[model samples]
Target: MDKLTVPTMAELAAKGESPEILFWVGCAGSFDERAQKITRDICKILQHVGIKFAVLGTEESCTGDPAKRAGNEFLFQMQAMSNIQVLDGYNIKKIVTGCPHCFNTLRNEYPGLGGNYEVIHHSQLIQQLIDESKLKAEGGESFKGKKITFHDPCYLGRANNVYEAPRKALEILDADLVEMKRCKSNGLCCGAGGAQMFKEPEKGKKDINIERIDEALALNPNIVASSCPFCMTMLSDGVKNYNKEQEVKVLDIAEITARANGL
Candidate 1:
């Protein structure tokens, strides 16, 4: 793995420098082992493209998405307000995040609490980079002609109308892009949204993640691409449940992008 350097907003501020954008490392991206790879890859992309970016580091907090989703409004507000205060103190005007939960909460829910910033998902940022020619998709990459199915994150897709960004990012790879029966506006959840991820499922007909993975498996995809860390966990668990981990790999969009770019 290549070493990565992520500047903290505090460090940049002390130097009388302001980053063009703030990289919000959501809870998963910061602490989840699997998600950490995606975090590093996004950092690699931003650094490679010469984007002046900084992270809040210890000043960052959970976006209160899970608390809000789990029906804890008071806790959610408290968390949101604390984060908003720190962001406002730093005068953060733009933010890019790897998790849709953070993106949705910051982009939509934060303005009400006085945290107004331009928020973008990593996928959208990658798409913009590609469009700007800061990133290029060259031939002969590892995924060329391999089948891949995209699992849309709820916050990124229907909740925010971001169906095109991840798809556009995936297009940079040399792969066969396939869609499950339920995708885009009609995509299925991986049984991890709305705080379901923290609690065991109630007795149900089937695990949502398994049911959704079944749809992906039905297409015989070589890779299951996801943009959210939560979705990645659930979908990867679904693949393991079916004992198909060897045949199929669950990957985040950032991981795929970094690999394609040889980062």
Candidate 2:
């Protein structure tokens, strides 16, 4: 896929312009190759919809989710303050993020520290664009009748009560969207939450991700969909552990929307 050339806030500000939304590319979106693809796909969507969006680029930092989760309040505050300074400098109000971890921190946790903004997950932005008719299946209907099951990210679903935005975006694909036994408010984690992704898991009879994947496999989904990049990693690892990589695909919601829209 050709890469989309996304602009930075500084570049926009140099021209005395401001974007409608600031695209907050979290740590994974910046450093992880797999997540980077999702970032590009989301950029394609924003470009396709003609939405003026900008990133912080080198100025963006971690949302301190891992630090706070790892019991490092001091570090979390340090990181948050730095980011808040940069954002406030730009007078940014609306922000969109592809990672639910960032979404959770920015929307729910940043206010107390004087960092307040209307933060939205990428899925929510995509759903809004589709609803407003800014985006559509121009080439053809993609994933029509294909079996798909969504694995809700803990941060995006239960934490923020954003269960419908993702599903609403998938509904545009016209796919056979299925739900796991545990979904929405009762969703299961992929074992990487609470800073677990950075360390080895303690002994458990069954891995959380494997357990979640088992439920997805039972549904025989053609694609196991995810919204968060961390969930994408855990679920893909789970599928590969079961030697089902070829049979099932683990994709981000942004990737699916981009492909469906022929971006």
Query: Can you write out model 2's per-residue Cα lDDT over 129-205, one digit (the tens) per residue?
Result: 88898877657447989999999999999898999999987887878989998999999999899999999899989
lDDT of 1 by residue, 48-89 (tens): 788999999999999999999988999999999999989998
Full-model lDDT for every candidate: 0.92, 0.92
State the local distance difference test value for candidate 1. Answer: 0.92
| Off by more than 4 A, model 2 | 1-3
CA error at residue 9 for candidate 1, angstroms: 0.8
> Would you give me the overall lDDT of model 2?
0.92
